[model samples]
Target: MLTEERYAAILKLLEEKKAVSVLELTELLNSSESTIRRDLTALHRMGKLTKVHGGATSINGVYQMTEDKTSVRHNLHVEEKNRIAQCAASLVHKNDFVFLDAGTTTERMIDYLHEQDAVYVTNGIVHARKLAEKGLEAYILSGKIKAVTEAIVGTEAVHSLQRYHFSIGFFGTNGMRAGDGFSTPDIEEARVKTEAIQRCNKRYVLADPSKYNQLYSVIFADLSQAAVITTALPDKQLRSHTTVIETDLGKEQTSS
Candidate 1:
């Protein structure tokens, strides 16, 4: 096949899978590794794709792209995430400096945090608005807005977070593997999450059972960094690594 045809085929595969590795392309195209690398470089230079260390990802293409991320944000773990959020919310103190990451689970924590005397630093636009409505001090980091998750990322977001320290941080990940660590679909979101971890004294990962033992495109922070992990029912491996806070949402809610 010609180089042009091979490149088109490569992009087609990426559209279906989101990412493609050099080894996989080599096997599929029956081409040498060096040739595949050249193609990736050329495509990246043409603004057609972004070349990562081991693979290439489509840039601004029709590969399951969504303008409104709010749809996928909710309905991930409706019941479980709400319970986990409530549990995390209970841990927040009156004057603690809390950092919240962008996730469906973490977003639910906003309602429970209402009327609290705390300063919240978050990269999530939705979370920031919720915190403001709750009468708390909310600081939304400014940077490039990621369309997929509606989270602020890029250099500005990282720089803004570096100056402040949080008492605790509540974050969520796309996937969690014992070896692969905490992963996300977008690399930009991963970068912001890494910085947030450094700016916090204590960190908690909020996720559901579905995220456990899963995988994503980018690996940001490792599971070991979590001070505590709040989930519905995590697997045994995750429990061994961190303090897993399990909650049963099905149980009747007790009045305060």
Candidate 2:
């Protein structure tokens, strides 16, 4: 099939499923992985779709960015998240107070933290447990436990977060746009993120390439609000406005 034909088919699949994986596309188009990757790259450059780990998702649609446990469990681009987590972890120093947001991307930091004298605050129940197991001072905010994502979100959590300030706060979001800013689907989640941002001395947004240019329910912060963005290849337009650090796990940080 011609490249145009393959791309058209890919777009149609994206419309139907709202997302498609490279493996799936390879099987559907009877093409090689390299060819499928190239197709995704080209389509992503045109802003027609957002690329995810092994797949792509529709850009124009009513997409809900929810914290479903099953979805998070099946999250594909974990390597990128690990890379981001490592980069985010590097910013931590001894005795620093850090607030880690609740998300799979932020959760990856649990394996990389080596600081022993740090106070780690988070609304992620799983993350708090991990921090505890690692022998760090973990503060788990009180709030409504969201079973779907195992996260705490509500006024209680937001109120609790406002009481403490952090030396650095790391957050992750569902969708981000230049004008609309960083966003999440849940209002309570957005509230917690915004509170964390305001209470921290420095703010970092942890996102994979899949999240850039997407939109959600509420805006948490703008591009200027972030000290750095650690991700895979982020959208070029978004990169132009902020300090974009591109990394493959174990590679030197390339500033874009």
Candidate 3:
């Protein structure tokens, strides 16, 4: 097939499947893997598709500058979030000092947490309340609350985070891309997240597959800075950058 014909075929497949791997494209187009890879790279440079590890995903529909309300987000990817939360919760041990970022997935982590002896610190008001209800020791940072995501943010929150170093911290990101790393829309929240991660010995970003290959306004942490806890990694190359704990719901196994 001609290069243009191959490009058209690849685009049509992406429009239908939203993502496609080089192997799949090569077989479909009766072409070599090298040719498909070059086509994907060209398309990626042209902004026609997003080239991810082992595959290319359709360009994200929109750039989100504003965050969805907690109520709305709580309903999205519920199953994946729960699985990711379960894996994250299992990482906590007795007497560990943890920082739980305000997010739907992190909030779900509270439900699976069995470590009552671990002390928790959070900028999430709801998280703090939930932790308390579970009879876990919890502390909320002193700061201004952003109503949209219901997370505490401001210089006060950043300063409060600096005072104590946490054994582990779980964070949420609006976007996670290869080079840009983890990002959120709000600058104030990003500041708080940056400070919180800096004060932790180990950091984990709780995200679902949909969060991959997206970029937001403010970047809080680099891809290498934290291990990603997700049900599956869309991009295989991500493993070369940082640790990714893929959670299997059925077997409850994690692979890095």
Instruction: Compare the candidates by lDDT and give the number of the best one.
Output: 3
Q: How do the predictions measure up, each by TM-score?
A: 0.68, 0.84, 0.76
Give the number of the best model, judged by TM-score. 2
lDDT of each: 0.74, 0.78, 0.85
Q: What are the per-residue Cα lDDT tens digits for candidate 2 across 135-172?
A: 98898999998876678989999899878989999998
lDDT of 3 by residue, 20-52 (tens): 777778788999989999999998889888775
Model 2 residue runs over 4 Å out of place are 16-24, 41-47, 50-67, 70-74, 249-256
Give lDDT tens digits, candidate 1, residues 38-64. Answer: 999998788676565456755532321
Q: Best to worst by lDDT, what's the order?
A: 3, 2, 1
Q: What is the lDDT of candidate 2?
A: 0.78
